[model samples]
Every structure is written in structure tokens, then in C-alpha cells.
Target: MNNQNSWKTLAVNLLAERTLLIVGIATVFTLLLLYPLFQMTPTLQASPNPPGEVFELQKDLNDKFPNSIHFTPFLLESLAGDVLTPNVLLEFKQRRQELFAKDAIGALAAGDLERQPYLVNYLDSETGVLMTGTHSILDPIEAGLIDIGTTLESASEEEVKLAVHRLISDPKTSAVLDFLSRHATHTPSTAMGHEIRLWVSPAMTFSVMTDNQKLGGGGLEIGVGGGPDVIAKEYLNRHIRDVMKEGSTSYAIWGIAIDANLEAQDEGKTAGIFIMFTVIGALLVVGLTLKSYWATAICGVGLGVLMIWLKGISSLIGLKSGLVIDLIVPIGMISLGVDFAVHALRRYKEELNKQYPPRMALKIGLSSVIGALILAMLTDSIAFLSNLSLHRSVIHFGSAAAMRFLLRSPF
Candidate 1:
């Protein structure tokens, strides 16, 4: 077999020229490893515009009302009670007044409320009707009774109960409660419980209402200037977490955006743990099965190179990796690299066992696998490229995988 002998001679000559292979490997590794240093951290944005008519409509809406859409975080506080009970209603009304006054002062001082944003109304008028308590519906003396403040000091428990019941059943009391429930964000926990809901404006004003209705008990809306995502994560979220940990259970504070980011971070940590496990398992299995330390090292190095290259390419292309990319790409690349490396190494061992020279064995191993690998990669590329019309993430992952396959072929 003169052709076989010629092939063996060529392989030997190539192997003898170790400098070329070393230089090529060094250049590839250096480029793959160093490129990441110049890259910025990836931002995760999931809701990029998709194709089709609905997306076009959304784009138009965004253009027409640039500042109309926003994510405003809300905090809810609730207190349990009968909506018409004098003392409970009084306390709730007083809390609202306190919050309103405090916000008014703060906004005025900050020049945010130079003109009153809300109208002055009967609630602010000098009505003898207290918004809460036994005398909430009528003046204490006008109701044919001693002043409630005086009665509470001397009245027996039964008398106090009777007074509260009388006040709750009053028509005037029903009117005031109806007004509040209509104007406020009201969600009743039970037949006896009433809730007040308020929107927190951009000026950090919050609504005052509370009851044990659901998780977080009640909600308060806060409209922070700048994006809610940024403010909630950087400032509001930290404060809320600290407040939650301080062992104060009187009220619960919930920030949906903040909670989501924290949960994502947790999932990322878990994914990292699994990735490390996968890498180690791959290395051990390859080393044992191939029975060659060199093969195992090559598999590990190939995977590392593929990951670095994917990240580098992502940066160069200005693609932000979303949750899907982060979850899929690393695992995908590792499995692909290991598969290629195992096939190559196994073929090399088979050639060696047939008593072929080392250089000839290496050449045959590479030649035997390259055609099948290229065919598989072509099919994979088609599948990935077909998805490009659907989402940006598909474009990113598909392109990255294609590049990684190209880069790993030489190894």
C-alpha cells in the first residue's frame, strides 16, 4: 500500500513540525481567553420585540407614548376591623391623615407640590362629623350623649360596646364609609374587614390602608423617578430586605420587581453549581473511558475554549444574553465539545491499537471523524438559523454555537 505509506510519511512530517501546531493552539487560546476581558457585563432583557402585527402595534404604542408605560412598586399595609367600628375607623382615618400631611410637607419642601395635586374637599372641611369613633357620625352632645372622649373614660365595657354599635348602624356613618371605600383602594378581607388602597406618586407619597387580605397583607404604590427596576434594586429593595430581617412583623413589604431579581440571582447560583458538577463529571468520564490523560485534558480545554469564545463573540456582536441563553449555551457547548473530543480520541486509540505509528494514527483519527462532525454541525446550524426569525435570543445562541463548532473542529 504505497498510498498508505505516503500518508504515514506526510503525517510524520507534520508531527515533526511541532512549532506550527503549538503556535496555532497558543494563538487560539490567547484570543479566546483575552477577548472576554474587553467585554462589558451582559444585561438581561427578556421582552424584546417579536415579529408580526401585534409587535408592530406595540412598537407604535412605545413610540407614541414613550413615558406612559412604567413599573411602579407598591407596598400594602392592612389592619383588621369592622369598616364602621368607631375606634378602628378612627385609627385608620388618623393614619391616613398623618401620611397625607407628612407627604404634603415633604413634597412642598422639595418643590414637588407647589400647587396642591389633590382638590380641597369636604373631608378637609370643618364638619362636626368625626371620620371615626362613636361620635364619627354626629357631635357627641348633638347625639344626646356625653362627649365620647368623656364617656370612654367613665363608661363600662358594655356601654362602650353599645355606643360603638349605635355609631356603626348610623346612616351618616354608612355614607362616610361608602365614600371612603369608593375613593380608596378597598379590598375587604372578610365581611367585617375593610382595606384602604393608595397610590404612591413619583414624589414618594404612599396610600394608607391596611387589612390581612393576602400576601403582604396590603399594598402601597411607590412611583420612583427613573425606572422602577433601577430604583427598586439599588435603593428600595435593600431597605426592604433590611426592614424585613429586623424582626418587625407588624406589616409586610412586597416589591415584585425586587423579589424577581433576587430570585433570578438565586437561580443563577444554582445553575453555576450544576455547571461545575457537569464539568467535573465530564472530565472524569472522558479520562476513564479513553484511558488517556491527554485525551481528558484536551476535552476539558476544548470546552473551556468554546465557552470563552462564545462569551467573547456575544460581546463583539453586542448581544445581551437573556435567561434562556445563560441557561442553555454553557451546557450545550460543553456537551458538544465533549462529544467531538471523545469521538476523535476514540478513533485515534483504535488506529494506535492496530499498530499504526503515532503520527499516522493521529491523522487517521482526525480524518475519520471530521466529515461526520461537519455534517452534524451543518444540520445543527440549519436548525438554529431557522429560529432566527422568531427571537433575538435564537440569533445569539445559534450564531454562538455555529462559531464554537467551527473553532472546535481543529482540536
Candidate 2:
């Protein structure tokens, strides 16, 4: 009895008399801890890396070929017959014009066309945007048209056909045509001649790749504006996809960075909607159970603080959030938070019903459940922290979750 009374006195002193001190310390700690929030860069991967041998080999290859360059491919499939028809080619040409306009980021240019057909970097001096050049069948097609003394705009159907044929027959341009043909095959037609069939594929694809300019002492300059070139390229790729999709054609734009950004955007949108619904549900549940608006508001505020602390702790330790971690952590925290709040509130109400004063009731309610709450925190932390060695993503999730449990013990 004496021990229980002493425990109740401690709870009263800590929660009631020193509430302002606790709040001040938590606010300061959270502010300091949240420094890493601005610097966090989340990475989403399908799965962890392969075993050590394969992973190390891949890492070595990356180190050796650091400037090999990566490309984003934008595949365009015509819903309306051959992709090489005069009308379709003209439309595609127009789209390219929009994509590579002077006002835009620009496209790849050939440094020495006569010696070797290769792309060179084109940087916009005014915009500080570096556009990695693009490789497409259209490049060679345009060259063939120029060789034959006509452009896509002025060329008739016959002229365009001639340009495509010349593109295929020429040794200089044939390699580009062959590479394109591999990805976008000709439409099968028994009636059409073999030459005509070979030149009229229903699909074509283009790729864009940028070069990072080397700075003094082996430093690299990606672009101004913290990778404006990166941003411009993503915008450029998305624009290409949008243009391709305009006329009922099937389109897919993919690159390492592009796809990752797209997936992150999609997941972020989904997470927003999910969080909205979860908040609403939590609010409704807490409000209905507590039957007190103040209590519900407090619960809501507490949940928000818990989330901030969770994120702050994870950020401090340099953990990046993924889709799985984003989804799981909130659900667990909300459920546990609501459970803890409801139990303690109900216990306090019970003490009040017995005619205990508010202070005594608060003390008794908190003191009675403190042991159970601490035990729950320990067990949950252990369970989550146990996953530390499983995978990189698991490590992030586990550490964040364990931090959340520890944070809850104070509450």
C-alpha cells in the first residue's frame, strides 16, 4: 500500500507539477533532433541488393565505368497504323520541335558527324541546363532527308518514303536504323513489298542521356540549381511521354532516375490519401470512445507529436523512409497511441466516478497504467529492433519503430 502511494505521488509530481518542464525539454529536444529532416533523401528500392559477391562486382563495375552514362528510353507505339507515315512523322517532328525548342532545355548535337556519328552535350548557357543528347531513328531519318535535299515539313509521302529507304541503304545511317528496328519492328503485311515492310514499323523509341561536366580536381558539375539539368530532363521526358500519348498512341518513358522519381511521386500521393483517411478514422474513433472533444483534440495533437518525434529520431540517425515504412509506421503508431490514450483516459474517468479529486484521479490513473505502458514499450521496441539485421529497409523501419516505442514511454 505504501509503495503504491509513493508511486502515485511520483506520477502527480512529474505529470502535474513539472508538466511545463517536460514540455520545454521535449520541444527543445525535438527542435534539435529535427535538423536532419531537411537533409533527408529517401530512396525506394524493389528489394535489397544481391549477395555480397554479386553486389561487390556490380559496385566495382559502377566505380570503373562512372561516366558510362545512363539513358531514359521513351517508347512510342502508334495506335494508327505505321509510325513512319508522313503524317505521323510530321507530328513526331512537331513534338520534337517543342521538346528541343530554344526556349526549352535543348537536345543532343553531333560533335563530328563526318568522322563518327555520336552525340555531344548541349548546355543552355542562360538557363544553366545541361541536356544530354538523344538517340533516335528520327535523327538519321532527318539526316537522310537533308541528304536527299528535303525536310520532313516539305516532303511528300513519296519523298518521306525515299528518305527512309536512303536511311536504310546508307552505311553511315543504317546502324541507327538497325538499332531502332530491333526495338520497334515493322508491321507484318503480306501485300506490302519487303522494302516497304522493312521501313514502316508501328513503333519507334528514343533515348536521352546527359553527361555530368567534370570540374577541376575531379569534382563534377551536374548543373546549376542543385541539378537543374536533372529536373529539366525529367520534365523533358514527361513532356515526351505526354506528346506521344496525345494521339491515342501507347507510350512508356523509363530511366533509372525518371522511373524512381515517378514511383516516389505515385507513392507519395497514395500515402497522402492514406494518411488523410487514417487521421479521419483515428479522430472519429477517439472522439466516439472518449465522448469528449478536448480529449479527442489532445489525442490528435499527441499523435502528431509522436509522428514528429518518430520522423525526427529516424532522420537524426540518417534513416530513409520507403513506401513500406511510411505505410506501416503510422498505422502502428496510431493504433498504439489511441489504445494508450483511451485506456488512461477511461481509468481517470473511473477514478473521478469514485469521487476522487482531479489531481488524485490523474495520479492514480497514470500510476496504475505506467508499469503496463513501459512493458508494452519494451516488448514492442525489442520486436521491431530485432529486425535490424534483416535488410536496409527493415533496418530503417525497425529503428524508427523502436524509437517510436521509446518516445511513447515518456508520454
Candidate 3:
């Protein structure tokens, strides 16, 4: 049509005559892509005061418990009956307390009392000790009257069986016995009448102790002064490792810090593999579908440029890209650009087959697809923008999509 011809002429003239403006736009987009404007904070709430009652609750909790953030590592242990009796438990507790006291003293002397760590066990609180029924037997254990090794060595098989049964049945020792039994690889039996044998069992003493420490005390928990940094977590892990190595070989340690680091490493590797596969697959599909090297290159370049421009706009508008945004933006832009380009190219080929002049064919192609492209862009923009009230991340995604649509409209 004459109107389409006129519009094409105007677009050509603008590109040819307003070269500086085109260059400036390109330069601005380049700078925006290269230099990001906003700092990315990958948290549940990226905004300073994100909307929602959940955020309000989070604020209230933070205000109430200023020093509540910390990671606690579980110290697991397995000990033989001869090595982990009530008296041995008492000895281990005393040693742990002594070590904590020594560390506290050293930290205080060095004026690093802020770095002092605390250890907690079942006996740390009266409630915990009472719950485990350890309070009643604490006196006997402390007095060194319950020497399990000596008794087991001297007592008859029947006496040992009776003693074991009595210990397991009493409320005072039942919890500890049950814990050890549960984690034990082999169950004990009095059926072997000639010789008394004790099997190795996993103990819940450390677990219960750590839990009590975490719940009843404050400093033993890691990350108290805000979520722990890498260095802090590593230091805590090292400290735990050192304690386990020096104190007893019977215990094993599993820290959140180590587990988190391993998980992150695994995630990074998986992402890298996925990205490689995605790039290869996209290239193969686009190249095969277009069949023309130039067309494939143009589509690829256009998609990259579109993403860069959208990211720049996002930066300018104080929007930070999170994992979801990073994934959605590229795929969305590619789908939009590819659909437009493919349809327009097909129309151009059809016009050329009808014996139209090259320039006229291009103009006709643009005329055929421009309306549809605009409609698609408008629909997509409206759909995304309508989700603004759902979540702040959705708002960010919608804004970026709208901006990309606007930037692509000129072409």
C-alpha cells in the first residue's frame, strides 16, 4: 500500500540521516549492558520494604530476636558399652565443660571474648537433664561409683545381664540405653552364657546435648551475629573438626556449613552443563529451520541484543535480576524475536516469488507482519503487567518484558 511504502521510506530516511542518534542509542545500550546499575541481593524480599504480611512478620521476628541467626552442626557418635557407660558420659561432659571454660578464659584474656564459643549438653539446663532422667544418676556418676569397665570385667555373665537389664529398665538410664540401642549395629544378648559381650551402639547423647545447647543457651549457635559468612562457617567447622579430632575418635561431625558448600558446588556444575546443552540445542534448531546462514546469524544477534537492552533497562529502573528473571528474560525475548523474524521473512519470500521488486517486497513483508507483531507485544505486555499485585519478583519480570517490547517495536 502507499501508506506502507511511505512508512518504509520514512524509516529508511531516519536510519540514513539520523546516524548519530542511532549510534548514541547503540552506545547507551552497550554501556547499560556492560555496567550494571543496581546491586543484586538474592533474598526472599529484594525490596527494602516488600509488600506482604509475611514480610511484616519477618520484621517483627528480627526486631524481637536480634541475635537469633546461626547454624548448628550435628556431632554424631557411636561408642561401645564398655567405653560409653554412665561414668564415661560424665567424664566426657566434664571434659567438654573444661574445654569450654579454657576457651572462654583464653578469649577473655586476649580481649577476644566476643569470639568465645559455648558448649551445651543435657546437663546444661535442669529441664533437659530432668527430661532425660539423668538428674537422678548424676550424683552416682560424679562420685565415680559407676565404673562400667571394672564392673563388666569382674561380674559374672548372669550378673552383667541383670545389670544391663536393670540399667536399661530404670527411668534414669532408659533414655541413654534406648538411644544407644537404636543406633547400634548389633543387639546385645544374654544368651551367650559363658562370656559377657558388649556390642557397639550409636548414642543420642551428643544429639540431645547439642539440641539442649541450641535451645537453652545462646552463644553455641553459629551465625548469631547475622547469617554466618563463609569465613565464619569455615572457622566453626574447623573448630568442630579440631574438637572431634582431639577429644575422641568415637564421634563424627556433620556441619551445615560444609553441606551448604557442597550443594552450591553441585548446583554450579549442573547449571554449567544445562547452559552448554541449551546453547547447542538452540543453535542447531535455529540454523536448521532458517537454512540461511545470514538469517540464523541475524536471529541470534538480534536475540542477544534484545536481552542486553532489556537487562540495561532493568538496571536503570532499579530492578535486580534474580534466578527466575535470568531464566525467563532470555527465553521470552528469543521466542518473541524469532516468531516475528520468521513470519516476516516468510512473507518477504512470498512477495519476491510474486515478482515484486526487492525493496517493495521487503516493505510488503513489514506491512504484513508489523500489525501482528505489535498485537503480540501488546498482549504479552498486558498479561505480564497484570501480575503486579502477585509478587515483587513478578513486578520486576513484567517491567523488564514491557521495556523489551518497547525497545523492539521500532524494528
Candidate 4:
């Protein structure tokens, strides 16, 4: 039974002498095990990080709007690059087929030379806005009947380019540009009287308060006397409002953002997490001082557990109370709580050190120091928790830390 001992009573008795050093080193190691969570630095005020602006924008968009397809910069560029391009490939295929059909030598080798048409390669490439089917009305084969018609048969590439441009200059494409705004950016640009409406997607996570903060979007209008575009912008504005009032925007956007935020098992949460740890630590404190499982159990078991939970809950509440907390903040808040619990235990140790022998010292310490120290913490906690009233996020941080200290107390 004696051999089953860990360090004997003497070693622990010696530890109680330089109790502060022991506690300090142990506290640091304990925190290191929880090092990841101790990230929430104590603060009386919360200063917003620059990136938090993204969250505010996300909230506003989500609570107000939904159903509108969230466009992203990459998606837009990829879509533009790939859309409506099948026809170009098809045209190239037909050109290749025409060349294969006209190869007289190959036709003869295949026993059909007599039926083959003369090899004539006609390539029409666009110089600018090329369209066709209406031209100078000269077919190379038909024009070859007259001497001047032969000139087109052997037309130079330059002549072909000119002819193609002449035919397509009045094609239907871009004809509407005259009516639409001339501010031609890939995403429309602002040309006075025309609003530049760029629908960047995954949606920006920051504030957008430009000089031209119009709540319109049908076609993005600006200028001295806005025309059709102004009407279009008004239409999109109402369209967006009607959609947002239904509360679909935030969910759609947050779903995408959650992919980028921290995960449940992420070690980074050590920055804000504190709990079972504080309980374990509190037990360690009682064990070292009381010198008996009976004393430690009486002080540290379920009661210590309750303290850990209560304080953890308080930290959690502060983190979740408002739009400001979000998921990242809880990690920092919990870490802050651990610091509080460690300090509380340290003070408890100081009181325990004053009396002789473990039992008498604990009794005297509890009777003398616990009440005053506890009452002080209670007063401090109330004042600390009141910090939640402040606008900055740090207020809840202070409250969470205070609550964590309350948990380790026997009360």
C-alpha cells in the first residue's frame, strides 16, 4: 500500500513551500495543452478587425435578399469565355469537310474524280464585326463566267477580308449598343447617363458606399439625364427588394462562406475554448493542497465540474449573443476563460499556504481567505459582465472571462 504512492507526502509538502513557482509552471503547461485556446486577450473594448466588414455585408444581404443567383468574379469570366461557342466549332468543321470533298486527287484515288468539283478553298475570316449572306453579290464561280468575275476567284486574302467586313458591317450584333449605354466594359462601365453595374459574386464581404449609392440595378444607370438605363436600374432595385424581403439571401451566401470559416475539430478554436480543462485544473489544485483524495473529492469533483460548465456556458453566451460574435470569436473567448480560472486557483493556493499541516491550513485558509477573495471576485465579475453593454465585441469577451473564473470557485 505504501509502495503504491506517487512522490509520497514529503514531495507534495515541499511543493507547497514555493507554491507560486509550482503553480506558475504548472499553469503554463496546462495552458500549453490548452495553448491554442488562450488566444482571447483580455480587453475592456472590442476593436473590429478589418475583415469583419465582410460579415456585416453578408448579414445584410442574407436577411434581406434571396433567390438571386450569387455571381462570382471567376464564374462570370468562365461563363463569358465558354458561353455560345459551339457555333464557331461547327463552322470550322464545315470548312474542313468542304476541303476534303474538293480534293480531286483523293477523289480519283477513291474512283470518283470525274464527279468532283474543281478544288476551290474559300475562307472567310472576320476582320471586324463580320457578318454575311448579303455582300457585293459576286460568287467566285458565277463571276468567273465574265473576265472580271475571275478576279474574285483568285481573290487575295486582303480582298477577302475587306469583302467580309463590308458584308457584315450592318449585321444585327451590337446594333443595340446604340440604344444601350456606350460605356463598354466587360461588366458595364459608367458613361454619364449610364450606370456601371458590376454584379461581383460570392459577393464582397465588405461595405460598399460609393458616391453613386443608388438602389437600382435593372441596367445600372448614371449621368446628368439618365435614359433607358435609369429605368432599368429602378426595375432591378425593386426586383432585389422583393426577393430579399423573403429572407433567402443570407442562407444562400452563408452556405458558401461556411466552407471557408473554421471547422468543429479545428485546433484554432483553442484561441477561444476553455472548460473541462479548467475543471481538471481546479481538481489538480485541490489535490495538491488537501493531500487526501477525501479532501480533493469533497472540493473538486461535481462542484468543480459545475463551475467549468457554468463558466463555459457564460463564455458561449457572450460569443453567441449577437451578429457581432459569429463563429470565429468563440474560440478567442474560451481561451480567455482559462486564464481567469488559473488566477483564481493561484490565489486559493496562497491562502492555503498560511496555516500549519494540510488540514489546519485548509480550514484556516477557507475560513479566513475564501470569503473575502470570493466576494471580491463576485463584485469584479458583476462589473466585468456589465461590459456586454458596450458596442464593441470585447465587452462579451470580458463577461466570458469573468464567468469562467466564477466556475472554478466552490460557490
Candidate 5:
């Protein structure tokens, strides 16, 4: 106990008496860690399961069928309630043609051409198409309309209705509608039984049929199966969304790639704004409460260091961050960091009020609260570390949170 007390006293003396030296060392350490933080590239993808039976089976299947294509599907929902109308169909046709146009897609990849001169690499190289092929509800209707010497452009409301009737009355085409209805939901048919007529109901409400099966809500789903790989597929998906957003009236477009891009945008663009506001709010509150420029400066510096330590250490240790970690970690760190800073600054102020010498006050202030700080750190860390048994993301959150708590305690 005496030896422990001696070491504690020695630490306090070093911090209070040798303040410049301690600050210099911390500055150097922070600078060193910044390099790794800048260089660190975290994997942003989320994987819910470990590499166990499901993954192994998938790998085996993939190996068995090496050339199998995973179709990235975009769901488009019409805001106008019905997709079968003449105007909507004409709009869909135009948008679909634009999506398949090489020049239009090349324009989207204009800046990226320096890396690869050809946009065909993002779609089908042989066909020079943006996607391999598309499966759309508009296909059959358009085909039926074409057979009757009319197009989406020339067809009137009465002409479109006649074309739909002809398609539904035909046995072969009627089978296709039956298959589509069985797979898709919110599709209004003439009969409630298995045999039904299309276009009998105008109002459509497209929704998910089950957990695994996904159908576009009330609009056509464009299939992106022909892209060379994941990157190419994502490129197609993003451009498709852009076209739909610009050309269509009211539409909800979503897919794996589309959703991922949206999330990445939120994190990349909006997170900085959120962090700026959080820092500003914290500093403002601290300034008002303390009413001392020096105290506020110290708190701000401490908070900055704590954040740097958290990010720098996590980067150095190769911890990956995605949407969940990026959102949760900083908020948690800032909240805890502000609390720790306030307690230390308030304690230091109290010591100063008691008429202690500056050095004595510094030592006494830090020493008085450090034990409680350490206890809080340990408990917080343990609680976060308890998530080790959960998913990989949860484990990362827990580990990073715990580590940040430990880093903040010392500051």
C-alpha cells in the first residue's frame, strides 16, 4: 500500500511539476498515431454471420457454379398508384431505354474514365449495354401493344386497355401473368382464385411477400444480372437510380447497391456535420457553465485529445468501422468524454478556490478524482466488453467503446 501510494504521488508530481514535458510527450504520441488514423481503411460491409456452415455451403455452391451471376434487383414503386397507365408506361419505357444507352451511362462515369476508359466494363462488354438484360412488367405489355400496331408513345388510354385485354385473353401470355401474380403481391386480379385477369383493379400496393422473397412494390424491378462483378453491378444500380429519380414522377428505388450507396453517403456527408454540431454544442455548454476561458480551453483540448486517441488507437489496431460503429462510437465517446472533462475541470477549480498553490492544486485536483475515474473506466469497459459474445459489429462496438473509456479516463 505504501509503495503504491509512493508511485501515485510520483505520477502526480510528474504531471504537476513537469507539465510541459508531459504535454510534449502526449503531443508527440498523438502526432505519431495520426499517421495510422489517416492511412487506415476500414471494411464498410456488414456480415451478420461467422464463416460457418452457411458460408461454407455458399462457397461450395459458388465454386460448383463459378460463372453464376448474382442479379442485383432495384425495386421501383410508382407514386401515382398505378403503373399500367399510358403516361406511366411511356415514362417507364423512356427511362428503361435511357438506362440501356451507352452514351448516357458513359456520362455518369465521365470522371471515372481516367481509371478505365470504357464504361462497357461496368455492364456487358460484348453488347456494350449498361446491364445484361432487364426483366420488367412493362415488357409483356409493350410487346402486346407492339403486336396491335401501336407503341407506348402512340397508344391512347383505350388502345392500352385493349392491348392489355388481348394479352390477358391469350393462353400463353395469360400464363405469364399468372406466374407474375403468384410471385408478386398487391397485384389486383379479376378473380380471387388461381386463375385471374390482370388490369381488373387499378389500385396496386406492392410490398414484400416474405422474408426471403422480395418483389418490387407496384412498379417494375430492373434486373442487373449482367454486370461483370460487384463493383460493376453497383455502378449499374446507382446509375439506374439516378435515371429513375430524374425521369420518373413519383418512385421509390432501392436495392442492395442503392441502399449501400445511400448509407455511405449519409455517413460520408452528414456525419461530419453531426460531429461538428456535437463538438460546438459541447464547447458552448462548457463555456456557459464554467464561465472561464481557460477552463473551457482546457476542456476542449482534453475532449479533442480523447477523440484523437479513440480514432487513432482504433485505426492502429485494425478495427473496422461500418454504419453502426461510425454512428454509435463517436456519440458514445463524446458523451463520456464531456462528463470526464467536466468532473476534472470542476475538481481543479475547487482546489484552486481553497487557496492551494497552482502546482499543488493541479496535483490535488487530478489525484482526488482519478480513483473514481478509474473505477468508472473499469466498469464501463467491462460492460462494453461483455458484447464479445454477440455479432462481429457488436463486438467491434463494445471493444472500441471500452478502449475509448480507458483512454478518456487518463485524460
Candidate 6:
């Protein structure tokens, strides 16, 4: 062999041994550690699940010895009867305020219409819309005309409402209300009943059940009536802000991010396994083709290094975890590249075997197949690049593959 070829042979042998050992160790570690982790993944996921009920589970470590490494069972038992979380407190306050508001509006309506400061706006507390007439209001207290006198102040909400209804129905007090109650609830539904409208508090919830699903989204009129109060707006915003800071929402967010990562790790593993196997197949072909252990080893070493480089780059971009074959394709690339070189050399070796020495055989083989080797690679490149026209990502894939050809090129 030429002096140049001799150096090539030595370089290929030494590098191949070190690279192969690294690859083997890595494969073993991946199989032992990573594979087990991958397998245990399902159970790991199952362990932290059952999320939607995190509120019911309050875990507080019992610390009898604050300085020592000691602990006790969750102190949830102590919190049982008094387990009112922020959410419960919020709901209680909201319900309580609604009842209080309902009572206030009731008292306003139950009193004598001839007395009390009139509620100026006919407001729909639910929708925040307002009108001029007081009697058109839904809540009994907004009616300006009801004459309960001071009885409304002392009476229960139910009792106050009854007094207002009685006053509205009294023929002497309200000829128009007496006529309206014949067809419906004494509650006024027009601008003419200004005294009655002032009593309305529009925050009541209403729902109608139906047999027809098509009619479900149709004809719904919801409103809000309490007068515009800037202080309430700020308080409501604070409550919503507090809800967002709760632990359940935080856990749910972290759980989702972790679940995505686990899925990605699994995909990368599958791609890595398949690529490893493909490289092994290429190594076998190199073994069968080359007579020199050093020459065959060159192909394996170059392919392994290329595999590591491609994997490292893909991982840096996080593509390896999410992308399947595309991420692993770099593994098969080096072997494929050098296989062409080996095939070219092999053919010339057979021809020289008849009458030539190793150097003559090697030179002739390289000269004979260099063109064909490069031709095959060009063909492969064209085939891969053609797919780039279909997808933007394929363009990057083609470049990566073309790089493998360059890295794997042996004289």
C-alpha cells in the first residue's frame, strides 16, 4: 500500500477501537438505566395522578422536632371539621352577600311607597343595565309605591315580600297593580309602575329545562343590576387574583409540563434504539467486506462519531426528543456513506486478486469505484432533497443527511 494509505489504515484502527468502546458503553448504560426509567414511566405517572381532587387532600407535615430530621403523618385529621379553604370562604361570603342584598331590596319595596328615599335607577344588577321607572324592577323592594310603612325594617325577607304583594294588590292603593296581578305576579314589568320598579335587584339566577337540545342556546336573557360601584370591581378582581394563586392550579400546570416531557423522552428512546440497530447492521457489512480489521474499523468509528455529533446537535435543539426517524437518521448515515467506499474498494480488490499485489489492488480498486461511489451518494442526496419541496422541515433533514455523506467520505 502507498505511504498515505498506510497512515489511513493505522488512524482508522486506533480511532475505531476507542469510538466503538465508547459507543458500546453508552449503549449498555442506556439499556440499563434509561430503559428501566422508560419502563417505570407508566407507574411514575400513575403515582402522581388523580389531580382534580387535590383540594380534598390537604397535606401538612407534622413537625414535633423542627431541627431534627423527623416527621409525622399529614395533619389533615386536625383540619377536618374546620377545613374551610379559601374557596369555601369565598363561596360563603358570595352567598351571604346575595342574601343580604336580596333582603335590603325587599325591605325597600315592602315599605310605604308614599315614604322612604326613592331608588332613582331601575337597574338590572345582573346585566348592569338601568331604566328610569322604579316599579318595572323584578325585586320587590325597588317599587316606590308599596306602603309597608316601617314594617319592612323589622320583618323577615319572606314577610316583607308578602307585605309588598298585599299592598300592590290592595284595590284602594293600586287600581293598575290590581289589574296586573290578575294575569301575573304583582311584580310590575313596565315603565308605568315606577314605584314598583325602584325595588328591583336583578342578581337572581334563572334556568329553564327543556326536552329539545336545539332550543338550549336560544332566547337566554341574563342581566346584572346593582349600581356601578368602583370598590366592588376592585374587590372582585382581588378575589379572582387570589384564586389564581392557589396550589391546585400550580400543580395542574406542572403536571401538564412534566407529562409532555415524559412523552418526548420516550420518543427519543425509540429513535435511539432503532438507530443503534441500524449502525450495528452497517458494522456487520463492513466486517464482511474488508480483509483488514483496521479498514473495517474505520467505517464503524467514523459512523459512530457522526452519530454522536448528530444526536448532540438534535438534542441541543430539543428535536431529538420530539422527532422520530428524522432525529435518528444521522446514525445510519456514516455507515451508509462508507459502505459505498468499501464496495468500490472491494470490487477492485477482487480484480487485483488474480495477478496484483495489495497496493496495486488497492489503487486500482479506488480508481475504478470512486466515480460510482460518488454517483450513488449523489443519487441518495437527490432523493432525500426532493422531499424538501413538500415540507419545510425536510429541508433541514436533507442538509443533515448530506452532512453525513461528507463526514463518512473516506478517500
lDDT against true structure, model 5: 0.59
- The digit string of per-residue lDDT tens for model 3 on 192-309 reads 3533334444544332122222222233322211223332443444454455336564444344343343233334335434444554555566678767788778666666566567
Query: Residue 315 deviation, candidate 6, in Å?
Result: 9.1
For candidate 5, report its TM-score. Answer: 0.76
Compared with the true structure, model 4 gives a TM-score of 0.30
What does the lDDT read for residue 119 in candidate 5?
21
Error of 3 at 262 (Å): 10
lDDT of 1: 0.48
> Which ranges in model 1 have alpha carbons more than 4 Å from their true place?
1-33, 46-48, 51-53, 59-71, 74-247, 257-266
Tens digits of lDDT, candidate 1, 1-411: 676566544544465457488658766766865555365645443333447798667557655544311222334232332222333323333443553454344321111112222211223133335322111232321231353443433444334344434444455443323222232332322222322221111111122111112111112222211223332333323432343323323333344454444354346547666667788988888988888888888778767666666667667666555555666667766777688778878998999999999877877776677678877777776776666755554666666656666666544
TM-score of each: 0.58, 0.72, 0.58, 0.30, 0.76, 0.35
**After superposition, candidate 5 runs with Cα above 4 Å error:** 1-5, 66-70, 77-80, 103-132, 175-232, 249-257, 261-265
Write one digit per residue (lDDT tens) for candidate 5, span 1-411: 674477567777788888899899999999888887788845343344455787567657654554323244555555665555687667766765665464333543321222221222123333222332344446666777787788888887666666666666666565434313233333344322324334633222211111111111122212211112333434545654676457467444555444453345356446656777887888887888778898778777877887778878888887666555566677677777778878888898899999998878888898888778878989989988987753565667778888978887656
Best by TM-score: 5
Model 3, residue 185: distance off in Å is 8.6
lDDT of 6 by residue, 1-411 (tens): 575566445444444446568667656644454433333322111112222444123211212211111000011110122211223223323433343343244422221222122223333443233433222222233232234343322434443444445444454334323212122323543332324421222111111111111111111111111111212222222222233223332111111111233344355557766777777777777777676687677667666555555544444333222343344465557457666757865776686777887655655556556656666767776676666543323544555566556545542
Candidates' C-alpha lDDT: 0.48, 0.61, 0.50, 0.35, 0.59, 0.39
Between 5 and 6, whose lDDT is larger? Answer: 5
Q: Clash totals for all models, in order?
A: 12, 2, 3, 28, 0, 34
Best by lDDT: 2
Candidate scoring better on TM-score of 2 and 3: 2
The weakest ten consecutive residues by lDDT in model 6 span 69-78
TM-score of 1: 0.58
